[model samples]
Target: MKGTQSLERALDILFALGDDGETQTIAEIAQRISIPESSVYRLIQTLERNGLVERKGQGQIGLGLRILELAKSLNSQFRNRLKSSAAPLMEQLSEETKETVVLFVRTGTNVICVKSVAGQHLVRFVVEDGKTFPIQNGASGKAILAFETSKIINQVIHTIETDLVDDFLEELQVIREKGFSETSSEVDPGIIGIAAPIFDQANHVIASVTVAGPGDRIKDEKLSAIVPHVIKTAKRISSSLSFSTTLS
Candidate 1:
């Protein structure tokens, strides 16, 4: 570790533990990463003191609960950025369509609504923030899932009804082709939903922009009419997210 700075050496120790959450003794980590045992011990002490590492057994160390806290904080920050970027547009969409507008972010195998603007109409569907659903169930979730990597898509596919897997994959392909998704009562009875994916600076799917309402009032030609507006809003939000990243 002579050529490596202290910070770099510490990071190397962390990486040496592997991404699988495997625990290792200091000597094992030092030997695996080709660093001195004394240096590894010193760095582990620093990391343990900061609550980033913990003793898993008598001699083994593993990642600590604080790492999960740090990850949650990071995820919250990204969601906050998405909310800031999508809030104004969500309001505009709700006003234009007279329907509920929602911003959803993928969390694990589910998508959670992070921001929502209720519809102006007397009879409307109210989707509360923090509502969670399977990542492949609703229009908003499908929009996010369709753009995910094949590995992740397959992982989700394996969890569903095997008989429906083919149809689900086909629907995802159509969503990718049309650049948006639409559903009627798939997740909730009597609801219509339209959504498009939002992208980050790296062109990765970060979240989705969605419009939802009572199916009776928003079906057929009416739903079709709102599709373009939802797509446009998604693009605007994606652009805003990229711009904010640039500024930061």
Candidate 2:
């Protein structure tokens, strides 16, 4: 195989392992990828030496701690960038709307809260850092679903066990057309949130910024008023990430 092909296969193996989230035998991996068991074993050995995969039991292998280390390092770097570039914008949004502002990034089929700032209100909602939520239940998730490729969006729809796929796509289309998404008492009763997508350097929606509060505090008029501010803050974060103005 060519060098690039080999590297791609290695990454594919890593992704497969992550998807399974458990140790698998060489034969199982080989069968999954339609590759020969001998080749799979050789690749597994190489990956083991590099600390990318580890043997868990007889003929079973899984991802190693090095991958976790790398993930942690990347997360730290992203958090630092967010603090330096997006934190001020989020703080400004919170102050302007007197609501909780949150930053979310896609993690597999879920969105993880990376940063948040609560408003001055005594009954404000709080989403702790590192907390994760389903991709079909919240404004931040809908913001991502609206902008991601159709392939990814379809995969999410296929995995859902409910009959709300049509409704979800209908709402996503509206959000895409309007440049933001909103949910009122969808994920949490009496709570509402508004979110706008944040683009990456390649103009892909890589994350989102959301402003949320209790429904009583975030009435229809207030939510409509803060939509522009939330969209503006998302644009600022996207700009800092080197996304083109066309995507904003």
TM-score top scorer? 1
What stretches of model 1 exceed 4 Å from their correct place?
A: 2-46, 55-61
Expressed as tens digits, the lDDT of each residue in 159-219 for candidate 1 is 9999999999999999999999999898999998999999988989989989998989998
Q: Considering only N, C-alpha and C atoms within 3 Å, which residue pairs clash in candidate 2?
A: none
Which candidate achieves the best lDDT against the true structure?
A: 1
Instruction: Count the clashes in each prediction.
Output: 0, 0
* Model 2 lDDT per residue over 1-248, tens place: 67898888888788879875888998889888888888788888889999999999887899999999998998788767766678888989999999999999888788989889988799998889999988877999989879998867887998876688888788889999999999988778998999999987787988999999999878868878999999999999989878423444
The C-alpha stretches of model 2 lying farther than 4 A from their native spots are 1-48, 53-65, 243-248
lDDT of candidate 2 at residue 7, scale 0 to 100: 87
What TM-score does structure 1 among the candidates reach? 0.83
Q: Every model's Cα RMSD, please?
A: 3.1, 4.8
